[model samples]
Structures are given as structure tokens and as C-alpha cells.
Target: MAVIDLSKLPFPDNDLEKFLDSVCETHELDFAAYAGMNPVTQTVHGFVNYPQEWQTHYVNQNYVNRDPTLLLAKRSIAPVDWQRLRQEPSFDMVFSDAHDFGISDQGLTIPVRGPFGDIGLFSVTRKCSAHDWALLKAKILGDLQQAAVHLHDHVIQSEALSSVLGPPALSAREIEILQWTAAGKSQQDTADILSISHRTIEVHLRSAREKLGALTTAQAIGRAISRGLIYPA
Candidate 1:
């Protein structure tokens, strides 16, 4: 499958809707949705490829506050399967209404942690049997995770959001180190290539992490890429 190049997207609502449609087509999913929280404003922004009525109904009812899928997924580091939430009361409260719209209960939500405490939830659903759902999920799990990050980064960096949350200012050396790390180079390897000591590389990485508000080097690299400081390698 061709990799979805979300960086090329313009981030308009229509474009995001089209992007979700394409994702659904590619993955054979019935629907796809992306919700992102702006940490500074504590406002929720998102788009979905579900039926228009369902979207309106979700908003009218203010289901975002009571939806177990969103609530449970927010607390989880891993993807939250809808199967696990079937027993929850909130699940019934939200999904019971969803059923009226022809939405499926079998789905998965991938949680993406961004710099600046932003969180993105990317969900995809399909109407399929248990065995088929398992096989399909196992096959596309990695791609879904990548899509989640790609969409989240683009959304958070878009013009609509840039004013509230500006990209971090990273130094040239810090960017260089992050670029190398994104390319899968180890600290010692980066040091060797840059003609610096490993300890110096570690310092630069630590500084980069601090600047990017990342808890770890991996997250720093992700944020750097999202901010256009580096490219995927």
C-alpha cells in the first residue's frame, strides 16, 4: 500500500474529510474519525467520515463528555478496542444511539500523545465478524498508528491551531541530533557522525527534549518532525 502523505494535505475541514475517506477506502473500514484536544485552550476539534446525521447527533447530545471510547482511550497508552468497552455503561449510553445511525460497535481507537500535552484520538470502524476483525486489526494496526500520528501532527500544526500553540524553538545542533535520531541512529552513532562525544550527544538530546516538551528522545523526534524541523528517515 502507498503511504498516506498527510504532510501534503492543506488541513481544511473538507480536505480532512477527504483524507478520512481515503483512509477508509484503503483500509476497508466503514468509517474513520479524528479528534484532537488543544491543550492551551482545552477545546476539542475534530472531523469524521461518518454519516452527517450521526455527526450532528453526537454534537447535539454533547456525547464527547460521556463517550466511554474517548474517555477510556484518553487514559490508555495503547489502542483501546471497542470490545473491551462493551461492558461499560457509558459505552451503552453512546453506542446505543450510534446503532440507530448504522454505526458498528467493533472498532479501535488509537491514542496519540503530542508535545505540549495535546492528545489525538484516531478511530476506525468496520462491520465484520469477530475472526475477521481480529485478522484485519492485526494486519493494519501499525498503519493505523502511523495514520494517527500523521493526522494529529498535521492538525495541531495547521493554521487554525498554530496561533494558540506555536512550534518550539530548537537550536541547530539539537535539530541535527534529532534528525539523526529520527533516521534510526543511536546516540553513539550520531556522536561518531557529528564528531562529538556520546556525552555531548546525550546533552543535546536532553536539551532538545526539554525544548520540545517531550518526555523522551523518541517523542522529541516526533515533535521535531511535526514542527518541520526534521523529516522521516
Candidate 2:
């Protein structure tokens, strides 16, 4: 088997409309939009850098709270198809919101949840023939979900998820060792807390340092604390 490189791959890291642009290239959609948000805060937080007028109008009117598509997506974990929503009278207000903002009535949104506390939506908007939109929606939903998931994971890790979760690192065993170490546990005590042996605890600690890329046990302790892997007393 080929070995996988542990080094980080360089991604765009931040580009608005990356997901939408990607889907547009492959699909018939004319506009691609993205929104990275804090679900708990009920704020858009960030979007794919749309026009200033669009942003200002969206915020000034508080459309998200009134957006039927967002409400449907949140209530259901699965991808909520726009065509399905359009037929529901409860969501007819969505059309009003779109019209108010001068947005196309045709669009699909995919919401993605990820580790380290990340959530976002990827959407494709089009003002095109009905047949074109049907084909575009069919071809693009799966890709939009994948892209949204990727961007969510990227945001959670890079954007200081200390507000929620953080740094998807280590394992339960590593955390047990680190906690004991922080409590001034001897290797013997660490092993005792974990019902293992001192040598085993040492192995766990060494593995944790390597896994956390910490040069010292103290550094490991600090890193774990900051990442919410271990709570401070």
C-alpha cells in the first residue's frame, strides 16, 4: 500500500463562492453562493463575498429568520430540495423573500455540519429555463453537499472553535493520560486512573505528544487545554 503524507495539503483556505463556482462550472447554474454560519448564534457570520447590495439588503431586512428554505433545512437533517419546497404553501414566503431581494426563484441549498463546531450552506441560483434548472439541480446537489462539508470542516478548525468544540485531535485514552498528568498524577497514578500500568501511561503520553506535535509534556498539556480536550480545574 502507498503511504499517505501526514503534511497538510494547501487548499484555497478562503474563497467566497468556491462551492458555487465549482458547481457552476459543471452545471447550468448561473450564480453560486455560500454562507458559513454559527447555527447557535443564528447569524450568517460569513458568506462567499457576494455584492455589497446583496449583503446589506439581506442583513438589513433580517431575511434569514424569514427565509423558508433555511427553516426547512434546519428542521430536516437531509438535503431539502427547492422544488419540493416550492410546492408547499408554508414556504411560499420564500418566493417573496427572493423577489424582495431580486434573487432568482430557482435555487437549491445544502447545509453541512462538521467537526469542531462548523456549519454552513452551499447554494446554486439560476434564472434559466425550467429544463436547465432540473438538470442542474439533479447534477449539483451531491457536489454542493460535499463542498459545504469540506468548507465547514475547514472553518471549524481554522476559525477558533473554542466557542464550541476544537481541534479534532487525540483519542479517549490520550485524553485520560493528559488529564491525569495535569492533575499531577504520577505515571503510576495515570495508569491507575486508566487501570493500566505506568509504562502504558508513558506510551500513551508519548503517543499523545507525537499526535499533538508537542515537543514537551508541558506543551502537550497547554495544547490539550486550549483545544478543550481537557478541562482545567
Candidate 3:
């Protein structure tokens, strides 16, 4: 199976079309789309590599609210295969029009949960037989999941989105402690370096974890780095 090193991809800015195009080409997919919901604002932002005509038609018809793929994927922890949604009426309603644009219903949608309450859905489609689609999905599913997380992080960290949803607030002491921890220093070492009591370090670390919505100090460091709040040691 092919492994995609999504970390090497450029971080997305306002335009995600190029990023989606690269994902499709790398994964041998026909089309790629991303939809992310900001829990704070309850607004959905999307990007797609589909034809412009279809894009316009989807919006004109107000399909965003009724698309089964998006609805089902949003509620699923695992990737939602188009096969599973084929029996739904909304599936036909959306894909019947999609077919007119030379698109196929052979697709998969992966959902990524952010540390915050945000959610991102990454969908890819291909025109292929059921057997071929199954094999393709099996081979690329892991990479697609990685891509989903990468895309979600970059999207939520984008300047446009950050402007609306402010980045996690970490105080100076909290950041200092996290930096030391990321540098492989023990809590005692960090306390000694800062000339503070070990209990103070613990308090700051706990606060940092809560602010980043991280379950552990290590996860907090990773989330901090991904959000450009701290650098990797």
C-alpha cells in the first residue's frame, strides 16, 4: 500500500483547490472535496475539485443541507463508503445530478475530529467497478485518514478561520513549560531551569492541557505546534 506523507504538503491558505487536486492525483482519485464545520460559529466551509458547473448547481439547488454523504459522514467516526449510502433517497437525489457531470457514486468520506469541537470531512470519488473500488479503498484508506487530519489542522489554523475562531490562549508560563517539556525536559528539570517549584510546573501543564483540549502533556505540545502556538523541540 502507498503511504502518503501529508506532512510534506503545503499548508492551505484561502484556496484549497490546488491542495485537493494534488490529493486526487497522488491517490489516483477522480475528484476530491473537503467540508469543515467550525463548532464555535456553526458554519460550514468547503472546497472541491469538481467542475465549476456542478459546483454552481450544487449551491443553487441548496444541496449542502441535504447531501446524505455529508450528513452521514458527519455522524460517523469511521470513513463512510458510498456503498453504505447508496440505499438512501438523498443519495440518489444528489448523485443522480452528480452523474450528469461525469461523476460517479464510487466514493468514500473520512471524518476527522479536531482537538477543538471542529470536524472536517474529506471525500474522494472514483469511477470504477465495485471490486476495483474496494481494492483502491483498502489500499488508500490509511493515507486518506492522515490526509483528513492534516487538512483539518491546516484549515482550522488558517488565518481566515483563526480570525473568526481565536487560537487557544496559553499564558507565558504555560507556553514556557510546554516548550521545556517538548524539549525532553522532565517536570523537575523544567522547574529547576525556571527556578520555580515543581508544583507550579504541574499547575501550568494542567492548564495548558485544558486550553488545548489535550488529554496529555505530549498531545498538548503536538496540538500547540500544529496551531503555530509553539515550536517542536
TM-score of each: 0.68, 0.55, 0.66
- Sliding window of 10 residues with minimal summed lDDT for model 3: 1-10
- Order of candidate numbers by TM-score, starting with the best: 1, 3, 2
**Which stretches in model 2 have alpha-carbon errors above 4 Å?**
1-13, 17-20, 39-42, 87-94, 100-102, 116-118, 162-233
Candidate scoring better on lDDT of 1 and 2: 1
lDDT tens readout by residue for model 2, 141-160 = 76566566655555444544
Q: Taking the candidates one at a time, how many backbone clashes does each contain?
A: 0, 0, 0
CA displacement after TM-score superposition, residue 141 of candidate 1 (Å): 0.8
lDDT of 1 by residue, 119-202 (tens): 989999999999999999999998788678767766777745564667567889998989999989999999999999999998
Candidate No. with top TM-score: 1
- Model 2 TM-score? 0.55
- The better-scoring model by TM-score among 1 and 3 is 1
157-179 in candidate 3: lDDT tens per residue? 76365646664579999989998
